[model samples]
Target: MCDDLQVSYPKDFKWSSWHVSCTCFLMMTLKTQSELITEINNGQNFSSEASENFIANTPGNFNAWLSENRESLEKRKSKPYFLEENKKFVK
Candidate 1:
């Protein structure tokens, strides 16, 4: 899954039981709407134009925005991006 997502780690990095537990916890957890929006805006998953359009269209209504883009967001979240992004914390 990490390879499929193109999330690479250091060649010397090793996955321990703690790392696996943390990864599983991250995958199973539900992120808040704000966290999702922030991630979408900050991430490379969506183009700048798309992010701008989402913000413009939503106008502070994250719930509505989430409802409209739930599937895409879920797909994005399912990727190993979080593992890569939060690798420091995991380590």
Candidate 2:
């Protein structure tokens, strides 16, 4: 069950351990660590657009860049690209 579902569990489970098997089986239906990481990466990629836009909208000079893109940068940071993504697995 663990291997099929790609999860971590105790390897020394004894024979006739129905509870262990049941728990492991139940865990199989849940998302794995790799799945969670993949979800997070997708979120970061989604947010990267905001970051890229911030860089693109900046002026040539540092102060001008900060002044010009301050609002947009903050708005981008506030966007819950990752939060919205993680919420998908909330069920």
Candidate 3:
């Protein structure tokens, strides 16, 4: 929502390119954190096979990683430095 794209949420509120969103104003291509990680690893952000395995399944693998890291991630989200919308909900 903070980004340039205007988003609208419906009752179900589960539309997503990678994560959740309901509607989008402009044509937007959103990438999951896993995808970004995969790209970075492939492009030499860090050279390792670990990143390869980590993002091998695209959204599913990254989503699992998110589940695994939820507690620490919640703590990070609690910080004021995070976005206001994210402050309301962890997702």
Q: What is the C-alpha lDDT of each candidate?
A: 0.39, 0.35, 0.40
**Which should have the higher lDDT, number 1 or number 2?**
1
Off by over 4 Å in 2: 1-60, 78-91
Could you estimate the TM-score for every candidate?
0.20, 0.19, 0.23
In terms of TM-score, how similar is model 3 to the real structure? Answer: 0.23
Output the better candidate (1/3) by lDDT: 3
List candidate 1 segments past 4 Å from native.
1-60, 77-91
Worst 10 residues of 2 by lDDT: 10-19
Candidate 1's residue-wise lDDT over 6-61, tens digit each? Answer: 22233233333232334431122234566567877988354333432232221233
Question: TM-score order of candidates, best first?
Answer: 3, 1, 2
Worst 10 residues of 1 by lDDT: 51-60
> Which of the numbered candidates is closest to the native, going by highest lDDT?
3
1-91, model 2: which lDDT tens digit per residue?
A: 2233232222221223222335433221234456557768887333322321222221234234335655775677463232233333212
C-alpha lDDT of residue 44 in model 1: 38
- Enumerate residue pairs that collide in model 3: none
Of 2 and 3, the candidate ranking higher by lDDT = 3
Q: Which stretches of candidate 3 lie over 4 Å from their true place?
A: 1-58, 77-91
